[model samples]
Target: MTWRPAGVMGVAPSLVVALADHLQKLGAVERVRDPADRRRQILTLTEHGRELLGVCAELARSADAEFAADLTEAESAVLTALLDRLTGR
Candidate 1:
């Protein structure tokens, strides 16, 4: 994430670190030393984070459906494609 944040997530590495630290403090994520390389740490989402993401996914789907209600099916497909491209997915 620190290396690919700009392209993959559209955020700065420093910003990701800050946000990850906060989430860790909030029990949404945990950081542990890498078994193979003690100098590095791996970040993994906790149960809380998974639950939060599930809720977020639901809300995002609802909002996207509402936002696309007026567009034709082709237009909706194009919009989704464009968004996926922009997000480097």
Candidate 2:
């Protein structure tokens, strides 16, 4: 999703700005003025950022599988459903 400064929620605006700055410095993202509106800027992920996110997703999946290794399939399925409910997904 394209994120504008005002779109950030549940965090301090200053923290969001700082994180945005850090991401930009890491070449993870860029902010560009909206073509139709000079007063607004849109944040876009860079190719490197997309790659990093893919790696992160893979690692998360690995960790999740490992965490459930000791559980029976039914238990894991129940846990997954519980987590999905808690996460509002």
Candidate 3:
């Protein structure tokens, strides 16, 4: 997730930290200390975050379907492949 925002989305690491702090405040995620490494923290999604993720997934699927409505099945497949490649998925 950090790699996605920093590398794929081209967001600054500082901004990502700020956003992470904000999410923590909002109870979307919780930070847990790593057992093996006291210096590191692990961020895990909360119940709220899981629900939000499900909603986002549905919305993205809807958007993708709408965006490809006019294209043929083959064209949509090509577009999806291109998008997956571009997103480094």
**Model 1 compared with the native: what TM-score?**
0.75
lDDT of 3 at 32: 91
| TM-scores, each model vs. reference | 0.75, 0.76, 0.74
lDDT of 1 by residue, 3-84 (tens): 4554566777788889889989988899999898796778899999999889999999999899999999999999989999
Q: lDDT tens digits, residues 1-89, model 3?
A: 22255555588867877988998997889989889778666789999989888889999999988988999989988998998998885
- Runs of candidate 2 exceeding 4 Å displacement: 1-9, 35-39
User: For each candidate, what is the lDDT?
Assistant: 0.86, 0.85, 0.83
Give a tens-digit lDDT track for model 2, residues 1-89: 55655444657777887988898998999999899889766789999889988999999999999999999999999998999997773
Error of 3 at 74 (Å): 1.2
Off by over 4 Å in 3: 1-10, 35-38
By TM-score rank, best first, the candidates go 2, 1, 3
**Candidate 2: residue 26 Cα off by (Å):** 1.1
At residue 39, what lDDT does model 1 achieve? 68
| Displacement of the residue 62 alpha carbon in candidate 1, Å | 1.1
